[model samples]
Target: MCLNLPQMQSRLLLISPGQSYRLAPYLKAAERLGVSLTIVSDSRYSLTREVADGIQGDFTEPSALLDAIIAQAQTTPFSGVVASDDSTVELAARIATRLGLPTNSIASATLSHRKDLARRQLQAAGLPVPEHWQLDLAREIAPQLQGLPYPVVLKPVSLSASRGVIRANDPDEAAQACRTIARIIAPLSNPIERQTLLIECYLPGQEVALEGLLQQGVFTPLALFDKPDPLTGPYFEETYYITPSRLPDAIQQRIRQTVADACRIYGLHQGPVHAELRIDGNQVWILEIASRTIGGECSRSLDAVLARPLEEYVLAAAMGNPLPVERRSGASGVLMIPIPRAGVLRRINGVQEIRTLPHITDIRISMESGQVVETLPEASSYLGFIYSTADTPQAAEQALRNAHRALDITIDPLLNS
Candidate 1:
């Protein structure tokens, strides 16, 4: 979408690490538009390669991060500000609000980032949210868990990518899960405290991920990704995301409607909205929603529809420009390479063999040898991402499975173990 804004120097300020899995496509989009971008990040992006100026800082400190962004803006104002992940979304909202840019309200951003707040708001809106409780680390969680049903999900209030999200089948399991989550979040410093967590009755149904944009509190559905692997989990490590949904059109529309209502309830009036929803018969339960696109390499599934990258749409929307929405015509999918165990990555073999799969488009191993890799309930990073597109959603999904089967990842025990 192109906007009819007054002609002036346009530069976007992105709040994300350069190495972020979500940055490359957006960088490509900005490059195509010749839009200069400045980044506020903790690390450098290889994709930028000195092309984009970067400011180093702790993104977790919202106030300090906003101050840095404000200081930079005084010298060279930004046309828009955007976040690269769940951690930065709040900061981006603050920056956009401070700059008087078009974006969702800070309150909305807060609700979107914090699971506890999101559940409260949705419940108040009369939306279907699982029965849950907000437990403060300062108190005894066991007493609070007395009446709540088992097979509940215990999660960090603001963590993303399923980090610290654990499903407990009983009281004993719930207690252990809480302790495990506390340990996982202990070292992180953020506005939301590690002591705060949400435990909700686990909803049973097939899960689907919705990626779209919200304009004036209305939702424009872009893609709906079907999670082929059942997420019925002790731990949810997302794998395949196949789009051009296999769900019936009626069911898909219902999903969109539910999500649109959710955006309104959350007060998300603009920018990208990535939502996870579950379906069981006629019931549609929203698991969670983010005021951003789908995270990780999963987002690549929706890129370059109608010759425009997904980031292009996001940028246009941020500037309040009217870029026409276009989605890729056929089926597309991405397999987020899940970490199999907690160990030091030793080597990755058989990339050449994986590439031999007919539908494989790209194979990227994100983690390097020597780096420690851990799976869900403690980790956010994926081992890598595999991309595939086919004439049908089933074929694309199968290709991802086939390609994954061909790779051999070697992880050695920790040095001290």
Candidate 2:
């Protein structure tokens, strides 16, 4: 969509966790568009406070946080609220609602983050959803697995980026996966989320992600990403996201329509939406939809398609500016460099060579040499991200793959610690 700059400098409240990679992009976008950005986070040590006015509150205690925000609003009122990560979307919605700003309903925001609730809502709306049921971690799980479908995916109700998401092929595997995921959730601070898991019949098909925006219940398609890697797995660690999808034009249109329908069902009437879906033959199953943009540095790929960083669109929309819908052209992609094992990073090689490869735009290694790294099913962070833009989806996909191949990464085993 084309940008419609706001008439005056609009003050925005951005609710983002301290660890989010999204803060910087939004900050830069706000500066370019002349928006006054205030960062509200749960961390006192947030670096964003150095530049932007920041408010730190205990996100777990929303009532207190809202009170603090309201107090600040009385002096320097905020025109809108935006959530920079999935973990903060519900809180953002609540804040927006309390301030009488445009936002999704609190129930809709909550449903978007909780898989179990979202599945039920979608099914009730007659959307194509997989067979699913919730399991209580506090109860005996073995008997509950009896007569259930084989090859099901067990995932935490609240976690995103595929953390604690595992696929099991049999009862034994399911039981074991349940126990492991339980342990993963145990350390989490949310007690309610720690006690629930969503188990669904695994749908087999190629996966694709749609990045779009919504305004007053109308959806605008921004970009559609093709996940070239086969996500069929015991653990789904996302890799390459290449767009302009190779799929037929008709199928892509259907995918966009399905997502728009989901937004209506979720009552998401404003801001950015990121959705993941699986296509099996003519059937399109909704896997996930978030009331936020695509996570991590993956959103950088959209810059080539949108002709501006996606954060600009997100920020402008939050300020109630109308965005012009632009047709996507050319091809761009990103590879979320995966952590190969659990250990401390020791060394990285071939970075210079990878930078020289054709179509490779940038490579960022987010982890330091002495920092610890982990693999998926337990890990949430990627080693870094590799970006590329090309003439076609095939070329873009190949560039990312080629860049990954050039990397020689080494990690010391965790047992040695």
Candidate 3:
């Protein structure tokens, strides 16, 4: 089946903050769907000569960007407006509303980005959320730390990819973590984004990621990923994602129901939802939910199992087209190569050896040699992604583990820079 949508409009506007691996796939999906896309970006570095219809705008200033989009729409009306990642979600939501395109509301987008607000909304809806306190970065944080439970997590309100997320074991460590995280937040150009941090009691359990879609307030699950590695942390760095989840049927249903409930609580009626949850036996807690698909190259695992590209489904959803929710057969997994140290990347060895392993479908090393690499608690990207598939979840996971062990990575000191 081609997954063709004849009713979708021919033109679209994509708002992306920079050049990312995400752009090429979306462009390919648009081409396959016979849709013309106009790239709207804040940075021109990632825009290539191939993108003939491109616009540069101030992404941080939504009102000005909306005007620019409106002017462009007058010349060529858009069938849909979509954002590639979290940074552009709000802008895309606003543009879509003005153009009468399908999208989540601005309030939904805001809740998706702000952790504190999302937590409050969920808690009020009688949902299970961690006990959390919001600390204003602009004022003294010392007074706010009193009487809170030990072993809390300190993280910036809006940052993603686990950047600036730290675990503090005590009051003293929490204070230091707050100061460190605030310093990380201080240089951000968005002042409103820089002013708050969330202090929440750290839940102890295995983590899982849910990838699904919503259409007119109805939920359709796509895949559920199991994070085999324990994410308990001083700094939580996610490395592995294996799916066709190994959890029992009851647990999986609960996870799905909880995430769907969260969507309703936040008023997110449409688009892809990438959610993080913590589970200990039957008790499940929602960590974070975004109006986007799985982040990074991890989405590749789903692509390997699906008949159509994941981007194609996302694009179809944005156009208000019905998508087949069923996934292709088999167990697939992805390993996000974690950076061991903060330094300059020198070189990666054993790529051929890793690829030759049984059941190893593909491997991509995203960071080039000589690029400065930073690890978790400070950085937002990964070194590369490894993909694998097999008849069983254990076999698929083992294949990824074997492939990961075959390579050697070298990182030079920051002084070399």
Candidate closest to the true structure, highest TM-score: 2
Q: How do the candidates rank by lDDT, highest first?
A: 2, 3, 1
Instruction: Provide the global lDDT of candidate 3 against the true structure.
Output: 0.85
Query: In model 2, which regions exceed 4 Å deviation?
Result: 1-9
What CA root-mean-square deviation does each model show from the true structure?
Answer: 3.3, 3.5, 3.8
After the best TM-score superposition of candidate 2, give how far the Cα of residue 344 lies from its true spot, in angstroms: 1.4
The global C-alpha lDDT for each of the candidates, from Candidate 1 onward, is: 0.82, 0.89, 0.85
Candidates 1 and 2 compared by TM-score, better number: 2
TM-score of each: 0.93, 0.96, 0.95
> What digit string (tens of lDDT, one per residue) describes model 3 on residues 231-335?
888999998899988999999999999999999999998888999999987899999999887864788899767877777888887776766865788899999
List where candidate 1 sits over 4 angstroms from the true fold.
Answer: 1-8, 42-49, 60-68, 304-306, 415-417
